[model samples]
Target: MSDSNTSDFTNPSSFILQGIPGLEEAHVWISIPFCTMYVIALLGNFTILFIVKREPSLHEPMYYFLCMLASTDLILSTSILPKTLSIFWFNYREIDFSACLTQMFFIHCFIAIESGIFTAMALDRYVAICYPLRHSTILTDPVVAKIGLAVVLRSGVLALPTPFLARRWPYCRTNIISHTHCEHIAVVKLACADTRLSSYYGLSVVFLVTGVDVFFITMSYAQILRAVFSLPTKEARIKTFGTCGSHLGAILAFYIPYLFSFLTHRFGHNVPLRFHILLGSVYLLVPPTLNPVIYGVRTRQIRDRLLRLLTQKGT
Candidate 1:
């Protein structure tokens, strides 16, 4: 090969994304459903934001936390799906190195924020269920704002390192990323350098964020269950449990697929490439798509408010 050919192979200026490698012929067909999901997620989350902003009745702690959740979901899905659709619909697969890192940073950061927000929501439920009278005083507007800020900062600071570390590592060859989006570990693996530290750091960040959030959320729900069972009447128990149903569903929608993706990617190396990519995409896409539906159907207040808003807009 000539020096130019060697140079082109060795140090390409941009990376090509594999994007479901063997499904090359199906990209357009696959993009149709994904585009639908992205649309639903955007509309759902934006409606939540709109309802929260317009309804004074929803200006309390629970809805405030929900607003945080909706906002995070919006950012998360927006960060990922647009670029993915461009790849599928436009076949524009070239992503610059800096842009790739930037995407990786936002994706991981919002994921951390998503986990943290869910944990916060669990804590909110615990407070409201286990200690109703103190709930207002405990999660007052100022306190809720502070908690929201803390969750953002915590996720941001922790996730900031992963992309930076990856960017600084040398990549002397093979600029093709093996997935649809620039996932941190996937991109890191492409680097031609010792990535043990980066790998461990990524694992640690995941465990630290998701692990702690999951632990706290589980404990909160356990306490909530205990408190519900202790209710003096079956009616009270039913009401309390009903209130928690939406949150529980949202949690399952997110964590179950998320854990499956994480485990399969990190440990299930024997898994098919398509399965890994599909699972990861599902993990990212499903929660944002379903969370609004869960909340809208289950939370009577949001459902009623949304109906009213739509009715008003219709006439």
Candidate 2:
């Protein structure tokens, strides 16, 4: 570890994208756009939450999941964003080891929760599309609440080991994280001690937890499609697909960058340092900016409610 990196870790940071080579200089380019994205994302998602909370009709399993997701995105975005922007704009790169660990913990946890909510949402779509007649009964308040609680608990528990594991490592020289935030990989890699085992463990958790959740979400949607095709009427088919349009859009927007990041992390050194970093930044920024839009554009009920909320408030 270099002396500079070591010193940076001691006092930690306030609002900077620490640890990356040349990031202090590159902030003028990426940081500006990143800050803008954060503002728009925060505004858009909170609008959804406010509208959903104000209106009663919008309350349902699907919207509930949307609310969960919006809330998750808010938490996820705020977790690293301010500090990341601070690093860029304020030139702050110091972060306490404990603070960095907490950041990594939630970064992974909320993302995992997003995955879980998405899976539950797929199941909701399946119930609504495949068993329209039984949707009401199969997706009752109790069931939905159970799923929500389960999602939160599952994501939270999976991340419980992260801080513990991170703390056990003998931190070496520098604490300069190579990315904008305290991302799990970057934080672990900064450890002067051997991080191979810890890195593998974290990666395994990602695959087993988030990856598996995505696989099941895909499967649920596939089953939904098959059931849709079974409908004897064309109108039913359109309705079935329409019901999932927003969800599909949100899923694609959220997961594509995630998939890219996962892949690049697996094989990106062959590319450029900028490549992986850029992809991860996009992954963090894009979903929060786009999620509310997807819901507003596709889900008519939420759209109408949000539109009314905006109009009434002259926003």
Candidate 3:
């Protein structure tokens, strides 16, 4: 599987995706778990959405934010898994230049959106725990809607430039992307022209979005912890902490692997490309697969609703 043409072109007709450079032999086996996770992600997130929408009691600001998170996870996992599975199962890896860019945009855009939702969730928790009396007033339905709109806009506006930037470069070097999907740097690095600006811009967007969100989350949690500890009774403190456990788990599930993959991509020069690719793919799936489960297990309302639904179906 070599490039169909070796000559220079502003844009190749399509880019050949090499599923995972060093793990071609294990692709079928790998597809099993990837496909399984995709199914789980779909089922879990959709269940969350359905439960949240149907149960009027679950329509609080917290559940609203959870719905947003679920939707983002659905998009984020979907943008990559279908194509990835195609490559794995059928060896169908050629992606049109435009399609590739579209995938890249959606993937990155939703990632930022997901991060924003996490931040919003943190704020929701912070208000619920720290400013208990004003929580409802602070996160009214209109405010939540506005926040959701802002999150989508911020992520879309920031990621919108990525495709245009990548398209501007003459990709005369080769049309083969080393990783599973058309990642920003993976595609841009194939350009025969200078890619410093694109690389720097991508880096800046990561820092700008992730850095700011992280700072806010940290500050929110710090205040939350203080408020939780200041409660008069042990039961009050335990109950307050319980409310946030799922959110903390979801946050860790997303950020830890994401940062690891990002750092490995940019700085882990000695790290194997296959390891990085696998981690990147897993990170995309893990949060989506776990978020619903974490929330269901940790949130009494969700868990009760979910169990009741299951029991009804069984009966």
Candidate 4:
């Protein structure tokens, strides 16, 4: 522990992260699954990016959005996993203040960006299904590029305040975070100063990003469902719905755990601290780990291309 003298307390040299309160003995055992998920997330997202980029057949708006999602997943998972593993494996738990903020920013920024991408993907599917003739014209290459840019910009700008807000507070209290990573709320709670503004801003950003995205996604799917049912044939309806299955799965994967963790942290007093921390850690891992697999298995184009590449390698 550092000195609690006024100057030292105000701006500590580094903060210690106590990974998962009450789970100290099982940190090593717990890390096995986290490490495996991280590795799979890395490989799966990279594979998605590679296949999407190399295959000309995949040079479309949907695939482009998928590539963006993959890239975001890579960033989101990478932002937290290495440090978490270090904490679990080697007990290297000290994180510099600036680096902690950086990690926090990336984690939240990309999460918002990923939610935006999911909305964009929903829009892509909606346009493709409902207005097939206009899909290309509505979402041209330049349009897709602009959407990608907007998603990144929106998330980055919204998340930019988190670290600054956190930094303004003086940490007269202890500088030990009780989780594996420097989540904004967890880090800010250590401050002796009023953190209500920071907490409100964080909550507002979550609603602005995720709440709005979810509404749009739901509306898009509603329109899509209407259009699918209007189709003349049952087979056509099923086929159209099939195209959306992967996106739906990906959305559920990302948001379900995310919302659970958020709610647990904010309101679930009865929830065990270890369970919340573990859920928080797993919340970051599960989406990235599952997204590529969902798309690869449920999406025929990606699945075929992946199989072809694997077949070639096997031969």
Q: What is the lDDT of residue 111 in candidate 3?
A: 92
Candidate 2 global CA lDDT score: 0.79
- Candidate 4 per-residue lDDT, tens place, 189-307, comes to 88988899999999999999999999999999999999999999999999889989999999999999999899988899999988988999999999999999999999999999999
Per-residue lDDT, model 4, residue 91, is 92
Question: Which residue runs does candidate 1 get wrong by more than 4 Å?
Answer: 1-12
- Please list the residue runs of candidate 2 whose C-alpha ends up more than 4 Å from where it truly belongs after superposition: 1-20
For residues 1-315, could you state the per-residue lDDT of candidate 3 as single tens digits?
256546567668799999998899999999999999999999999999999999999889999999999999999999999999999989999999999999999988999999999999999999999888998899999999999999999999999999999988997777888888888888998898889999999999999899999999999999999999999999999998888999999999999989988988888999888988898789889999999889888889999999999999999
Most lDDT-accurate candidate: 4
Which regions of candidate 3 deviate over 4 angstroms?
A: 1-5
TM-score of each: 0.95, 0.91, 0.97, 0.97
Model 3, C-alpha of 232: deviation from truth (Å): 1.4
In candidate 4, list every pair of residues with a backbone clash: none
- Cα RMSDs of all predictions? 2.3, 2.8, 1.3, 1.6
The CA lDDT of each predicted structure is 0.87, 0.79, 0.92, 0.93
lDDT of 1 at 187: 82
| lDDT tens readout by residue for model 1, 2-23 | 2121233434456777788798
State, as a TM-score between 0 and 1, how close model 4 is to the true structure: 0.97
